[model samples]
Every structure is written in structure tokens, then in C-alpha cells.
Target: MHTIQQSASQVVRQVLAGKNLNQALSVLLSPSAGKNGLRITSQQRGALQDMSYGTLRFYGQLVRVLDQLLHKPVQDAQVRCLLLVALYQLLHTKASPHAVVDHAVRAVRKCNAAAGGLTNAVLRNFLRNRDALLTQASISEEGRYAYPQWWIDTVRNQYGVHAGEILLAGNRHPPMTLRVNSRRNSPEDYRAILARHDIESSLIKPGAVLLAEPVPVMKLPGFFEGLVSVQDAGAQYAAHLLDVKDGMRVLDACAAPGGKSTHILELAQVDLLALDKNAGRLELIGENLQRLKLHAKLQCGDASQPDGWWDGKPFQRILADVPCSASGVVRRHPDIKWLRRSEDIKGFAQQQLSILCTLWSMLDDGGMLLYATCSVFSIENQCVINEFLMRNADGRQLPIPAVHLNNGQLFPDDHHDGFFYALLQKNA
Candidate 1:
């Protein structure tokens, strides 16, 4: 337990220092192959992940709560972060207060004995004034929603009357949605398979399944056999929007972890080339393809520099799921709320424009390119699309049904992560 608490606190500290949660946890929790590697059990690792995610989920509010109680800013980053982890348990988890405090006090001593007294005092005071402090923190929208003030304002400015719903949705735990691999099993057949195992799920669309609760993918029947995959509902639209057809050439630019790349293959017999900038991440695409028994030409190359990889062949369809602030998937990755800044949106928009313009040339004269981002920010979505259309005469924005031309925003909900998709077509 001490190891678990220490590991969790360390994960939070790493994230606060600039690394993402996945990168941070992998450093502390991932077991090594050698005998010298840390031997952490599954239960302990699960605890560490839960505490780290929960701490970041309420990070904005918890930090404000600490500021309200602290007489001065904590000089040691680890000490303050440990307090945040303890506070997360006291407020969020069902763990006993005595055990939580005791473990935290011990964990703090393991880090810095000089700050041990401070940790104990702050935690106890919080227990006494928990209600009032939470109330004070809840007064501001940022505090109430546990998002950065700039994030709250930006979403409001873009979403207007729906801003509150969008902000609140990011804080809610996202549902576990999966996409069935049609080649091996239909959504209906997969649903029956789940029922046989006493696991309940509802189909949101033809190929999408929404679980009542999140489960380990390894436990899902036929998961290893590639009968289904873990993908959100909004993401499942990519393959459909791309409209992959038999014998058509498709380019899944910026495709990493290959969810849509695999989905495209499941729908059609397309000659797909999945390109991503990171070589290591391209391996993820390979892994997913191997699992689904799907095939795609995987290459590591920048989408903005097609000259490096493109063989002068035009693709019938392209899926440009560019990197962005990821404001939409905060529920799944709460660290994005802290990691991204308001100004970063401008940089992302510029990159999206570069990739969209570059990839546009690689598409067949009448081909379609679906621009997507797991972001609700307009600058990265419609603004980028609008700017690209203005600069290119051959490219025209194609309207997506039920999606606003200016905001193809899919607000975060129980069924899907907040996402934006703008399908563009090239005209001769």
C-alpha cells in the first residue's frame, strides 16, 4: 500500500511537471522483463492509476482548495502534489480517512521529513473545512468545473448556450464505447457474446457498442481474436465518413494507434496507407492490425511533407485526424485540461492547415478528405477548414449531416468523446 501511494503521488508530480499521464504512469508502474524490475501487482497498479486519474480530474479545484488553505506556496513540488493525492482520496475515494491520512503521512516522510508536519496539518484542516472549501472553490466556473479559466471562457465563446453542457461533460466519466470488427463479427453477434458472459452493453449505432461500465479489454470475449475493438462512437464515424470502397486507395494521415485505420479495413477492401510522424507510434498501428488480422501499408512520415513518403499516387479518400488541444477527450485524459494552453490553439491551427493543404494535393481530383480533431475548439476545427478553403481553389467544404458548417462539434456525452469532423472534397 505504501508503494502504491508513493507511486501514485510520483505519477501526479511527473504530470504536473509537464509529462502526460500515460508517460508518467508508464515510468512508475510498468513492470520490466528482468528480475530486477519492480514487481507491482495488478491491484496496486490499478490503485495507482485510479488515484492519478482522479487527482487530475479534479486538479483545478483541488489546487484552488490547497491555495485557500496554504499560508504560502509550497516550495517542494513533490510535497504539494502528495497533498493533492491525499486530498483526492479523502474527497473522492471510499477509502477510510484514517488509512488515507496515515498512508499519506508515511509517503510524505519517505519523500521529505521536513514537510511531514505540514502534510499532516493541511490534510486534517481540510477534513474540518472540506465543505466550506469545496463551496468556495465551486463559486467560480473554473473551480466549479475543475477546468482552466481560459478553457471555460473559450468553450463558452464557441459553444454559447451549450457551453455549460460541454464543460460539465468533460468532467464526467466517459462511457466505454467499442467498435465491432465487421469482418469477424457483427455488432449484434458481439452483443450476444457479451450477454453470454453476463456483460451488458447497448449498441449506439450499427457497429458501436456502449458498455454500462468500463471493463478490462482482456476480459472481453474475442477481444484477442479481434472480434471487436475499444473505440468511441464519434470516432467510429471516421471510417463511415471516409466511405472506403473496394479497390479504392485511402490515406489515413496522422493515424496513430490505428483505430480508424483498422475500422476502414473492416468496412471495405481499400488499399490503405496509414502514415504518422512517430515511428514508435506506428508500431501501435501494426499491433492493432495484427490483432484484427487487418492489413495496411504502415509508414512513418510527416503528413505536412508528403514528398518524403507519397509515391505521386492520389488517394480516393483521406482521413486527417490532426493533433490538437484534445479538449474534447478530457474525460478520458483529464491531464489535457492542464497541459494545453489558450495560445497553443493558434499553433495547432497552423499545423492543421499545413497538413490539410499538403494532403489535399495527394488526393484524387474527386477524392474526399475528412478533417477531424478530438477537440471542440473552433480554431482547430472550422477555422482551420475555412482558412484552408480560402487558400485552395480546388478544395471545397462538404457538409456533414446534423453538423453545423461552422462547428462540426460533437460535445462530450455519455456515448462519445467531444469530437469535430469536417469532410472536404477535391474538385477537378
Candidate 2:
């Protein structure tokens, strides 16, 4: 029990210290706690995990609830984190608030001598004002920077008011998605695998699967065997739309932890070159390939200046999954809601446009290029594609209809991550 409190507090402290929540938790639980020996129950372990993920997911709202309930600030690192954990349960979890307060008060006792009275008083205050907090936290920007104000405004402006609400709805929870490894298992075979494990999932498209209840990959059948990868159903569609074929010379630019790159390889036997600026992440890409026994030429290089690394020979197909604000995956990384600023969006747009222009020139004549980003904002999606069409004199934007989603604007919306794909075929 002492170890559980210490571990939970350590995880929360790292989150408050501005480390990524998932990475922080991994560090906290590395090889399990205890300097010498301690036996932690699965229930306790699950609670710590839930407390960490839940608190981060609703961090903006929880802090507001805490502020409303507490008079003096719970400033001690452990005490503050205890409050976050407690507040997360009081508002979000089905656990009784009294039980949550009891456990948190005990955890606080382990923190500081002064924390017991403060924790008791603050949690008692919460019980009294729960109704008011629910109303305030849900509406105010301070209470819910879980959704950014400028992002809210921009969504309203670009997509109109109702669509703005829909956009927010998109971040409420993560969509469960899967990418079928076409080399080992087709979409149909993967769904059958899910059925064999009593895990139900719907096939969204040619190679995409959407799970209603996402099990841990370890629990999923054949996960270690890499029969399928947990990719956004929308992202799964990229390799398919890319039209990678047997023995084609292809470049998967900006590929790190190579999901799409591997998917491209799975779809067809191709001479593929995968490059990213980060060498550390390249190892992860290599690990995924090793797991699947898939082969590809993986290198680390800047996508904006591929000439520094790439040979002069041009490729028949290029998959440029460029960097962006990653606003679409916010549900899975709630810290982004607080970390991102309205100013950052414009900077990302500028960089994304620069990358598009740079990589577009590298596409061989008569070759096709698939430009993708896991960003929901139009400025980073269609805006970049539209601007490219206007700026390029020689390159013609292939006219595609809304149905093909190749119309220079493909927003992957069906049971997938919010992704934008632009397929451009250079004229021969």
C-alpha cells in the first residue's frame, strides 16, 4: 500500500513536472517498485494506472474543480497530485467520492504532515460544491482548456457552429482503430482473428478495422506476431490510397516508428526508402519491421532537405506524412490541449507548407505523392493543399471528386483518426 501511494505520487509528480504522462508512468513503474521487496496487487496497479491516465485526460477540468473547492493551495508536489487524483475520481469515475477522499487522504498523510487536514478539508469542500463545479468546469475556458479557446473559435469559423461542436465531440474519447498487415493478414483475416478472441471490430475500409472496445495489444491475438497494428483506421487507409505496387521504387519520407511505411511494404513488394530526422525513433521503426519480418531501407534524414541523403534517382511513389500540431490525437495526449497555443498553429502551417513544397519537387514525373497529416484543422490540411495548387506553375493538381477523396483533399473521417491525405499525380 505504501509502495502504491509512492508510485502513484511519483507518476503524478512527473506529469506536473511537464513530462509526457505515458512516458512518465513507464519510468515510475520500471521493473515494478520497491527498493528491496514489495508485492503490489493487480487491483492496486490498475488503480495507479487509471489515476494517472484519468487525471491527465481531464486535467484541465480537475484543476478547476480543485481550485473551486480548496481555500489554501495544496502546494506540496505530492499533495497537489493527490488532489488531482482525488478530483479526477470525484468528477469522472464511478468510485464513490467518500472512498476516493479516504484513499487520497491516506496518500496525503504519506506526503506531508500538514497535508492530512488540507486534504480532508478540500475534499469535504468538493462534496458540498459538486453541482456548481460540474456546471462551471464544463463551460469556462479556464475550467476546460482541455479544449483550447482559439481552437474552438477557429473550428467555429471554418466548420460553422454545429460542426465546431462536432469537432469537440471528436476529442471526447479516442477512437479504437487497427491497421491490417496485408503481408501476413488481410483485413478479412484480421477481423476473423478478432472474432476468434471474442474481440469485435468493424471493417471500415479495404485495410482498416475499427474496434468498439480496444483490448491491450498483448491481449489481442497475434499482436506479438504483428498480424495487425493498432493504427488509426484513417491512417490505415494511407498505404492503400498510396497505391504502392510490387517492385516500385518508393520513398516514405518523414517515416519514424514506420506505421505507414510498414503498411506500404505490406501492401506490395517495393523498393522502399524510409527516412526521418530522428535516429532514436528509427530504432523503433526497425523493431516493428523485425517483429513483422518485413524489410525496408530505413535511414535518418531531414525530409525538407532529402538531397542531403537521397540519391538523385527519383521514386515512382512517395508517402510524405509530415509533422504538424497533432491536434487530432489530443484525446490520447490530453497534455497537448494545455501545451498548444493559438500562435503555434500558424507556425505549424508554415512549416507544413514548406515541407510539402520541398517534398513535391522530389516526386518523379508521372509518379504519385500522398501527403498526409494527423491534424484536424483545415489550415494544416486542405489549406496547405490549396496553397500548393496555387503556387506551383508546372505541377498540376489532379482533379479528384469528393467520393474518391482524391480531390486534393481527403479527410479520413470514417472510424479513424482525423487525418488529411492529398494525392497528387505529377504530369508526365
Candidate 3:
């Protein structure tokens, strides 16, 4: 337990130092000796992941409690992060408070012997005034919501009365939803298979299923056989909205780890070209397509610089799933709350518009391009699309039939992660 705490602290420290959470964990849990020079078992890896994510998810509140408990900041970075991790375990997990404190102290001693006493005192003080400390922490919006102040402000300003719900939703554990491969099986058939395995699930749509509990992919029956692929319920709307048809030429601009790309292929027999800037991520698209017995033309190039890769043919349908602040999916990536800045949204919006314009040039007459992002921010969603329509004389926004979406913005909720979609049709 001490080792897991120690490992988790190290991961958190890296994140605080500006490393991506997933990258930091990958390096820590690599095949070689871990950061602490210990071999990580499969079980330890799971514990480490839970601790790391939980700590960051509530980092705002934990830090506030720590501030009230301590007289001065702990000089050691590792020790500070260790206390945050311990606080999260105490407040959120079913882990025993005594064990959490004991393991944290032991982990501190191994890193900085002199700070062990300080760590012990701070944690004990937190336990003694737990209720008061929690009350104080919840006073601040950041503390109460577990998101940065700017993020809270933006959501509030954009969403008005519903900002609190959006903020709270991002801190919760995301649901595990799967996109059933309709070519191979139906959601009804898959639900029966899950029932036979004693796994409970609910049908979200024609091809999407929401699991009652998230099980490892390996534990999911026929996962490798590609009967279904894990995807957000909101994301499943993309393939359907793009309206792909047999013999249509389609381009997935900025496609990588190709969830939308594969879904498009699954829906119709189209001549699909999956393009992304990163070669490594493009490999992930290949792996997904292979597992599902699908095919597409894969290309590595910048989506904004289509001149370098355009094959002189316009696509009948295009899906530009552009990148953004990723505020919508913070539950799956808690570090984004800390890593993203308010200014970053504008930069992303500019880049998104650039990609949208470039991809627009490659759209055939009457071709539809769906501009999408996994962001709840207005600047990156409606604002960008609105600007695009103004700049392009031939392009006009199309109405989306999803009744839940407010103009094209889908806020994070119990059923789906936050996502934005604006379909544009090129007038002939």
C-alpha cells in the first residue's frame, strides 16, 4: 500500500510539473523498473492508476484542505503531492484513514526522511478538523467543483444556470459505453451475450451500449474479435450525422485513434481516407480497423496543410473532428483541468478554423463537412462554426436532429461526455 501511494505521488508530481497524466503514468509503469525502482504487478498498477486519477480529480479541494491544515508550505514537492493523494484516499475512497496516513508517512520517509514528521503532522491535523477543513474547501468555486477558476467562470458564463452541473459532471467517473459493430452483431444480441456473462448493460441507441460497470477490455467477451469498441455515447452521433452512403468518398480530417473513422466505415461502404498528423497515432487507427475487419486509405499529413496531401479529388463527405481544450472529457483526463489555460481556447479556435477552411476546399459541391470537437467551450464550438460560415460564401450550417443538443453544444451529463458538432453543406 505504501508503495502504491509512493508511486501515485510520483505520478502526480510529474503532472504538476506539466507532464501529461497518461504519458507520466506510461513512463512510471513501463516494463522496466518503475520510478521507485520497484517492479509493478498488475494489481499494483490498477491501484496506482486509481490513486493517481482520484488525487488529480479532487486536487483543488485537497490543496485547499492542506492549506488550512499547514502553517507553511511543505518545501518538498513529492511530500506535498503525497499529502494530496492521502487526502483524496481519506475523503473519497473506502480506504481506512489510519492506513492512508500510515502508508503516506512511510512513503514520505522513503523519499525525504526529514519531511516524514511534517507529513504525519499535517495529515493528522486534517483528520482532527476534517469537517471544518472540508467546509472551508467547499467555499471556493474551484474547491467545490474541482476545476480551475477560469474553467468554472467560462462554463458559468456560457451555460448560465447549468454551469454547476457541467463542472460537477466532468469530475465524476465517466461511463463506459461501447459502439457495437452493426456489421457483426446487433445491440440486442450483444446485451444477451453480456447477460450470459452476468454483466449488466443498457442500450443507449441502435449501436451503442452503456455498461453498468466498467470491466477491462480483456474481460469483455469478443472484444478482440471486434464485436464492439469502447466509445462515448455522444461520439456515436458523428457517423450518423455525417450521412455517409455507399460509393461516397469521405475524409476524416485529423483522424487518429480513429473512433469516428471506423464508425463511418462500419455504417457504409465508402471510399474512406483516414488522415492524421501523427504517424504513431495513425497506427492506432490501423489496429482498430483491422480488428473490425474494415479498410480505409490511411495518410499522414497536417489537416491544415491539405495542399501537401490532397490527391486532386474532392470528398463527398468530410468529418473534421478538430482538437480543442478537451474540457468536456476531463473525467477521463483530470490533468487537463490543470494543464489548460484560458488563452489556450482561442489558440485552439484559430487552429480549428484553419483546419475547417482547409478541409472545406476539398469538399465536393454539395458535400457535407461535420466540424466536431470534444469541448463544451462556446469559443471552440458555435463561435468557430459561426465564423466559418461567415467566411465561406458557399458553406452554411445544417440543423442537427439531436434534441438534447443546445444548438450544437452537447454538455457533459450522465449519458455522455461533452461534444460539439456542426454540419456544414457546400452549396453547389
Candidate 4:
């Protein structure tokens, strides 16, 4: 295992190269390039992953602290990133500030023109100002939550003051929740099966279990056997909402990585079509379907342009898990906080509207469509649904029945990622 300092330096270089934290980590941890492409042990690998994720998760506040202490304009990208890494270690990492700076300075030396002196100066300066900087960064909401200024304001406007805090908390990495395939084995049955392998799992809800420790799916019993699969509890609502039965046609629009699509099949026999815009993502859908020994007509096509891929058929059910700001799942992908812009919400709503309008014709009369998004932003959630309802000429809002759940809107940090679901039925 490489020292955390060395790993931090590498992560710093990746960040300096203009990559977001998750992107940088992906490359650094990509078996071919991480740790100089040397194979790291499993334990070391896990630690590096944690540090990289944690550092990026709080980069906003970390940078603020760095700026306060180092009273110089940081010009070089590499050195700037290195300084950020040094500060991250000092604040969030277990490394001693002195050792952190020493190793960072050496890392700088390895570059063509080492900034060892500057690195040393910056690190020591941060150490001297640590107490002050910590206090400053912790003073405000943005500092405390580590979100962008606009993000803080936007979430506040939508979810109000309290939910805004919840939104920020949700941006932390989500837990590894799994849904057992009830068709194959009951939840308790699977829990006992996992116990034999020392895999402790606690049932959080019926059919929903949280692994005490997430192990590789390959190591889990009946994973390849299709008894359980990794899925967030928030997402499991789809199978019931669609409520597929024998001899029904179902469309899983935007079904990349096919979790919901697979779950739908698990609930009952159905003629399923899982369509995604990206071929690469569709490959994952195919792989999951194969692994589960499930059958779905997996194809790559744009949901907004169903005519291009549709075979002139109407479906009894549709799952339009459309693309949106992804605000709800930010905890699982904290990089969305950095990678996404405020304007993206408007654009996502526009795209979703197009898909909803275009795909409406594909639904059979009296058939229902479940509109869903892993986004808390109003424009992408309720507002989009309202607009679509107003604009569509033949659409009828399906009243939420006892069987059809009403998940009005979920923001982040509410036990699950924020999500919105609306079930609509067309007049037969």
C-alpha cells in the first residue's frame, strides 16, 4: 500500500489536470494507472478510494481554507492542485500536517520543475493558519455543506431552509442497499444464505436489506444466481408502480444498467423492452439481464425519438425514468455537485417534456406510464409533470390508487435519494 500522502499527490495531479474529483479518481483507480499502475492490495485500494472520495466530497470548503492561508495568487495548475491535496490531508486525512507537506514537496520535485519550496511554504502557511481557516470555512451554510453558492440558493428556494440542509447531507455517499429477488428467494431466506458466508445483512424493509459490509457482488451468494441485486430502496418503487403481469407489454425507457427493468421482470412475467440512448450503457443492461437470466428486448435508442426505434406498437405499461439534473442521487455521485450547472435543470426539463410528449402516442389506451426522475429540483420533478399534463391533448392523470404509490417528491438525505414519481393513465 502506498502512503496516503503519495496517493493524495497522484489524486492532486489528476485534479490539476482539470478533471473533477470522481473523474480523476476513476482514472487514478483504474487498475491500469493507479499507484503508478502497480496493483494495490485490497485493503490499500479501499483506503485510497475512501480518501479520494472524501477529499472530493469536501473540496469546496477545502479550497476556501487554502485561499485564506496562502495569500498568493496560485498560478500553476499542478501546484494549485497539489496545494489543495495538501490542505485536504491536513483537514480531512489522518496524515500529520508535517508529514503531509514533506511528502507533497517531494511529489512536486518529481515534476519537471519541482515547486518544492512553494509547496513547503503553502503547507506550512496552512498549518500556521489551520485554526483560523477552519473557523472561517465552518461559519456559513455553504462552508458547512460544501456546496456551490448557486446550488445552496437553488435548493433553499425549492425545499426551503430545512430540506436544503437535508439536500447537502444527501450528497454524501449513499449506502449499499440491495433488493432481494422475491421471485427467487424471500428476503429472510437470502439473509440466512448470506450468513453462512459471514456476510451480515440487516433487513431495513420487506425485500430491502442493507449489507453490514458491502462485498463484491461476485462474492455474494446467489448474486450470479439472481437472488439479489444492488439497488437503492428509493428506486425499488418502480416494480410495484408498473405492476407488470403475465402477457403485458412494458417499456423501460432510459433503461441503462437495467436495475428497474430487471426488477419489473422479477415481479412477474411480461414482454419487456428496455431502451437506452447510449449503446455502451445498454451493454450493461444486456449483461445484467443475462446475469439474472431475465429476458428483455434490450435496445439502444433515444426515448425522446421513439419513432426511430418503435415498431408501431402501443404498450400497456411504460417506465419513463427520464434523464434529469440527477440532483436526487448526488450523494452517490458527489461529483454531480461539481459537474452540473444551474442551467442544466432547465435543459433537463425541456428534454423530459419532449420525451413525455413524444412517447405518449406509444401507450395503449387505458395503459399507464410511470414518470420518474432521481432529481429533487422542482423544474425536473413536479413542475415538469404539471407542464406535461397541461400541454398534452389526450393525457389523463391517473389517480393514485392503493396499489399505485404516491411518492410526491423526495429530496436528498431523507433515508433515500430524492426521487419523484407520477403514474398517468390514458383514456381507453
Clashes of each: 0, 0, 0, 1
TM-score of 4: 0.89
TM-score of 3: 0.98
Model 4, residue 158: C-alpha shift (Å): 0.8
Pairs in steric clash, model 3: none
Per-candidate RMSD vs. true structure?
2.0, 3.1, 1.2, 3.0
Ranking by TM-score: 3, 1, 4, 2
Write down the TM-score of every candidate.
0.95, 0.88, 0.98, 0.89
Candidate 2 is scored at a TM of 0.88
Give the alpha carbon lDDT tens digit for every residue of 224-306 in model 2: 88887878776776887888879899998889888888888887999999898999999988998988889999888998887
Could you tell me which residue pairs clash in candidate 2? none
Show model 3 residue runs off by greater than 4 Å: 33-38, 402-404
Which ranges of candidate 4 are over 4 A from the true structure? Answer: 1-39, 96-98, 112-114, 124-129, 398-407
Question: Model 4 over residues 274-346: C-alpha lDDT tens digits?
Answer: 9999999999999888888889998789998776789988999999999987878876766677778788889
Candidate 3 Cα deviation (angstroms), residue 65: 0.4
